[model samples]
Target: MQPGADDPWSAPVATGPVRATVTVPGSKSGTNRALVLAAAADGVSRLRGALRSRDTVLMAAALRELGATVTEESGPGADQGDAEIVVTGPVGAARGTATIDCGNAGTVARFTPALATLARGDVRFDGDPRMRDRPLTPLLRALRELGAHIDGDRMPFTVRGTGAVPGGAVTVDASDSSQLVSGLLLAAARFERGATVTHAGHRLPSGPYLDMTVADLRAAGVVVDVDDPTADLLRAGATPAASTRRWRVEPGGPRPLDRVIEPDLNSAAAFVAAAAVTGGEVTITGWPAATEQPGRMLPDLLVAMGCRAELVPDGLRVTGGGRITGIDVDLSDFGEAAPVLTGLAVLADSPSRLRGIAHLRLQETDRLAALAGELGRLGARVTVTDDGLAITPVPLHGARLDPHADHRLAMTYAVVGLAVPGVTVDDIATTGKTVPDFARMWATMLAG
Candidate 1:
């Protein structure tokens, strides 16, 4: 079924342990980042296995507007291995006048504006209603500080490009979103003086995403230097130390790349969670052996909550123990996975405290508040904390959940519905923002 086709979807309750081998689509994060870097690269770049979700489509369209020639080798519904996106970089010839619609995609909204600054004309950016409310000022202010002429502080603003950006050092407060940092660093290579970004705020949210950005840059032959004090501390399970993080990108645009994108691990987490909540075993194929995707933390996150996660030759397999124990953990690195994790928390045998994700409030929706309210509608005890959510297990009953137009929330609500009968989710179409054909995929998994 298409997204929103079943408006108030009665979530399918798991009648038995769900067993399936699922192959999820390519990574949205990787697809958009590749698109951005490719658009600024020195030669033609080809992305195989690129996700064809709404977000990536918008990113491709945005780049095309800026004079990049983006061509899909196959149809929109092509198989993963056959789907290829060939992007002809527009580094020196970006069109000056174009109107870009971000369409509620954060990467599209935040990352595209910086690329637009390199054009020699006017580039206007706007998005869905909620995009107006999302945080873009930090990135916008940073662009203005870097010698680009900008008209406004947020969406519905225009970036007046002079064919080149006078890029230099700029300190930004990226406490609300790491995209602010990634956006600048991605386009730094084309800047006249290169670019250096220093984070001047609380611990940067989604620190690993910055690492992914750096990795993508390096893979495309761009030179980057990073100094983050909290990296080791956070990995060791200690609270972050107060210190600044800095990244320097040299003034040489990226070389073209021919990359085979990895499957979307954050999206795969939903299916894994389905296994955990239903005492089932689900294997997600094409799981990367090594990567910087923040979803790498999913296996450990599940292991801590009474599930067995192992990486066999076939893929990453998660087997539920039939009882979920509560977990108190900080999810600052993978905030995108919070919604699905929150779904697991509500079904746990005890209390779960998820901290270090205060920045979620500024996302597509106020996630912490939305989770508390939606889960509470089904009789789950969820409290909103300053930085996270505290979920106490209770006998949850079925109720129609509102996802607030957030893709992750819709997937989360679907997870909760697997264990509780009569649970319905409104706007399941929102899941299309990342995972296309989600209804059919979910049904297929249960069918097995």
Candidate 2:
């Protein structure tokens, strides 16, 4: 049977040790961004290794709604092999009134609206109830300054574009989510005046995402102010010799670059966490030596918790030495990994403190609270602070773990099930939002 089958709940017992090398799919972050950029670009872009998960599908559908032609090329082996997404942009075409369903995807909810601002006429966007709770005021306010008409601050909003966005200078505090910044940056090059963005809020959470956006923008041949400091003389795309907290994208337009997307490193973390907890070894193929994906930092975190992490021809091998020691990691730069870290922390021999990720509160669910509550149901003791989680190595028993319709949280509980017996995960289907084959892959990874 295919993954995410008939059973809505998955409770796979770890029979003996987990030893397998899993090949995860493309990065959801990268795939969604590529989809948006391809749609916003002036020419057609082909995305090789694009992920086909619920989240990315929402992104693709949203782009299609905005009048882009998204073709998923299929052949004899395309279903099981690497597939490609060919996006024919509707640039300057009649991207008339359309409706977008974000479907619990923050990227689609936050990123696509900016792209819609480039299209003409009305574009209305709505999503799952949870999306309504997610933050969008900053992005909306920023888009408003860029001369787009928005109906509201949150989900179920409308963007009225007059065939062009008179983009110049706008500032938004990207401290909560970097999508607001990255989304605007992705479409900035297509703006009539280009776009200049500055962060007016506290330090941007997940600074790497900002860098990733700028890197992609530059790679697409958009002019970026390498350093937009107030003292430096500005270029043609300049708003002002701005503060260090600013980013600018020149108005020349976006260039479509043919590039293969990287595997979702965060998805790979699930297999790594399995190896970490079961005192076994798991290899992830094609692990990059250098990349911008936040999952790149997992090897370092694994090494800190009594695991042997090494890069070999086989892949990035993480050998769980049958013991997990307490790890104190400040995961500020990569909050996406926090759920995986939390699962490992509970099974450690000592207490682990994960600091500097309070921004996780604004994620799909109140991540810290949801993680604490779910693990607590499994007879684990965890304390939730304002910013992070403090987990003690309390022997955990099995219980039903609700996924809260969040894919990452669902996968995190699956990791715990590798060591603990009878850890039933409800709504395992929720993992389809990112890892569509999450359960089937887990079952295969556990095959003895």
Candidate 3:
């Protein structure tokens, strides 16, 4: 087994009871949309209780690059203790050309280009080397077809907006990331002519998120019409010009948000799987019964594996008593939870076959290969197909687990290592990008 000491994760330790109240952060998707909307709107938008994660930080920085004055302060009121971001619209035209470094923030990488259409001069969009390599060809082609001048089809690309965008029917293959489609839809609302987007292949993976984007656009005074089973369309029937606008963002924290961020079912899956693997009980609260986030399927899937999952008033409670069983399930909607599911598969009593997950290969890392490679190192018999993973349960003799510098991989493997005998990860600090207190929270849960 290859030691994953070179990766960014910590050594795994034993875990105890998983009872704890976790106050997850605000929704990354919502925060990004609010930032983009605030930037393009005419007035000073006060976004209260925004997420202060790496991804949101990147979006805020990108907004600044687009000539918006962004200021960060604490709370709706001085006593709330929640963070507030105030964005002043572009003074006149975007003052100067700027280079936006999106880092590994896919939201910034995808959405910033659309905002670039509003810039006065050329805006160069780039990101971390890994991010630069991620495919943006679909988005570039769509934008160019819409009359935006994009230097290259890939990153390190230059975008010069003519202050006007011509919209038409654009076909986008969003099999990689839904952010591409969302970006085009957002930019289309501001187009001189309306835009209609047709999915080139199978329907989008995160349908709920795409719906959320449309809902948010409507909230910002943009009229969006989503005719299901047909191409979703946005018609800017008339140019609705606003002199200035003010938007108050919902506050942050574990307390119920006006716009409750659907429980991070993706994150909770790790703990749920951890409890399953360790033959213990784990309960995650605040998971909405009606959540659009696809990751919310964790409890149902865990229950299929013979784990007892009960949906309580606040959240889902999971208990593992019998041996873990593997069942075939389609992960098209819940693609983000694939990493954790792969880890769970290794602990199952029978061979676990996950299907409808071809999109996993395109995430932060080639997740399918990364999972297979790392899990194989932990003595699991894992095989990868074009779509999903097929794994036969084995006693996980913890070897070094590499996170491939991806946050999801890091956290998922950390949970696996904790339940196993000896597992250590390299570069654990990457968890700070999303769930900074992952280790602390895990420690607290285990302490009880």
Candidate 4:
């Protein structure tokens, strides 16, 4: 049985030095986008090297609900071989409708509605209760403006696809999640006259993820035009008349493809933090130097915090000795790393302030609150605001931690427990949503 959100974790046991090569999982964002594109494509689209994490699995299941044929097969390589998900074109009733369960995945919840526009029937989208509570008003308003019939119920809302979405300018507030914007862009190609999008207030957080969406659309045979004057404005070309098209997903692990996903820098962050706090040396293998993911800035940030981190051919080598320093840095690009960095901040010599993370509140959990609240339980002074968080370096004492059923929070606190004795985390199972083998991998690194 799955553990409840309120459960408290066991105290952390002593963990020794960590020295081993670790292969991170594929990007959840990339796999989810590929699954959606494959479903919208005209021919049998094959996705290679796809991630099989909970989020990706939910996307696959959602596509299956939409009447796509998805297959999984092992690849013939050192890394997990290719997962051959074959998407048969949109074969369901032109007006067919289905209720999709997005589980706890924010990516699926946001992306699924846009895909519904191609269907001829009413698509009722539902998810875990927490997901329903997360705001969808911005995306809903944008879709309605584009002529989509959206009923605004919390979880049991119904979206009726008219196959006639207007291709004109629509402004979207993407401060919550960039997935909403990506979803609209994904469906833009299918519109009769194409579409234009403008970001309303502050620039969308995780802009790189949106850029990835645009790049993926182009790779899948969709044309997009960006207005130079305004960074937020974008124009998409009409869906290609040719329904049948073929594209190859590049393989991972030391590949030189232009757009292949680099190893998950976010996942590597936990181990990196572990090494830093324990005064140990751990090298994260498979990270590319030119990657755009915000987590890729770990080495530089760690260096700024007085840790020695070098980028190697394989991955990153981090060594810890000197006292950690407080940093006041804008994290608009690497918002996902904020939680782990917050944990590090608790051990720093001075107070640390992380800014530009207002978007974090809308993630899988209210990450800002979760971080501040849960870390406070471990005897740290953390203050959370609407925009970001401030941590006054306090001598951390080990205590039970509540992960709030968030994978990143669970893993971040778990690493924190390694340094601060007696720390335990509740609902560690949630880590499987992203890193299924987190326990085993962590054990292996400790064993080395």
lDDT of 2 at 111: 84
| Residue 328 accuracy (lDDT) in model 4 | 93
lDDT of 1 by residue, 1-448 (tens): 6556456877899999999998888889898999999999868999988888788889988898888889987734453322589999864445546889999999999998889888767889999999999989999999999998999998899988777888999999998889999999999999999999999888889988899999999999899999876766777887864647999999987999999888899999899999999999999998999999999999999999999999988889999999998999999988988888889999999899999999999998999999999999999999999889999999989899899988899899889999999898888888887788787889999998
Cα RMSD for candidates in order: 2.1, 4.3, 7.9, 7.2
Model 4, 1-448: lDDT tens digits are 3344455655354366555666667667777777787777666766665667778888888777666666765543213312445566653543246778888897888887866766767878888878877867788788888778889846768878665566566877676677767877876776666667766555557767776777777777677765423332233444332221111222111111223444667878888877677767788876777765667678988888877898788778887754678889988878988988998899888889999899888778899999999899888999997689999987778888878778899888877877788887888778777776566666677776
Runs of candidate 3 exceeding 4 Å displacement: 1-9, 74-82, 90-92, 230-263
Measured against the true structure, the TM-scores of the candidates, in listed sequence, are 0.96, 0.93, 0.85, 0.87
Rank by TM-score (best first): 1, 2, 4, 3
Q: Regarding lDDT, does 2 or 4 come out ahead?
A: 2
lDDT scores in order:
0.89, 0.81, 0.70, 0.72
Report the candidate with higher lDDT, 1 versus 4.
Answer: 1
Query: At residue 53, what lDDT does model 1 achieve?
Result: 79
Q: By lDDT, rank the candidates, best first.
A: 1, 2, 4, 3
Distance from true location, Cα of 312 in model 1, Å: 1.0
Task: Give residue 360's lDDT in candidate 1 (0 to 100).
Answer: 94
